[model samples]
Target: MIRHLVLFKLNEGVAKDDQRALAGAEAFAELGSLIPELREWECGWNTTERDIAYDYAINSLVEDRESLQAYLTHPAHQAAAGQWREFATWVIADIEV
Candidate 1:
C-alpha cells in the first residue's frame, strides 16, 4: 500500500474566499469518487492563522506505485490539474506509508 499526500499553497492572485476557490476545492475533493485507482481521497481548506505555507492537503491511498502513477495521470485528475496550475503557488509532498 502507498499513501500519496500532497499539500497545496495557492497563488497570491487567487482569492481563498471566492467562488473559484470553492469550486476548485469541490472538484478536487470529488476526484477520488471519479477515479477507481484512488482507494481514498480527502482534502480541505486550511483554517489557521499560523502562517502555514500550504492552503490544503490531499491524502490518497493506492494499491501500489502503478496505481499511484495511474492516479497521477488519470484524465479526471487532468481536469483538476488545469485548475491547480492556475491557482496554486506550489505543492509540497511526502508520499509514503
Candidate 2:
C-alpha cells in the first residue's frame, strides 16, 4: 500500500472559513466516494495555533503506485485539487506501507 500525505498552507489573509476554502474542503471530503482507486481519504483544516503547523492536510491510502497514479489523475480529483491551487501551496509525501 502507499500512504499519500499532503500538507497545505493557505496564502496570507485567507481564513479557513472562506468560501473558497470551504468549497475545497467539501470537494476533498467527497473524494473517497468519487475515486475508486482510493483505499482511504481523509482531509481537514489544522486545529492548532502553532506556527509550524500546516493549515490543512490530506491523509490517504492506495493499493500501490499504479493505484496512486490513477487517483492522482482522476478528473474528480483534479477538479477538487484545483480549488486549493488558487489559495494555497502544499507539500506531499508518499511512502510504501
Whose TM-score is greatest here?
2
Instruction: Report clash pairs, candidate 1.
Output: none
Where in model 1 is the C-alpha error above 4 Å?
A: none
lDDT to native, each model: 0.80, 0.94
Instruction: Give me the runs in candidate 2 sitting further than 4 Å from their true place.
Output: none
lDDT of 2: 0.94
Cα error of candidate 1 at position 58, Å: 0.4
Please write out the lDDT profile of model 1 over residues 1-97, one tens digit for every residue.
Answer: 8888787887787778767777778889889789999888888877775675578778889988889889889888888867877778556454667
Candidate 2 versus the native: TM-score?
0.97
| lDDT for predicted candidate 1 compared with the true structure | 0.80
- Give Cα distance to truth, residue 3, candidate 2, Å: 0.0
lDDT of 2 by residue, 29-86 (tens): 9999989999988998899989899999999999999999999999998998899999
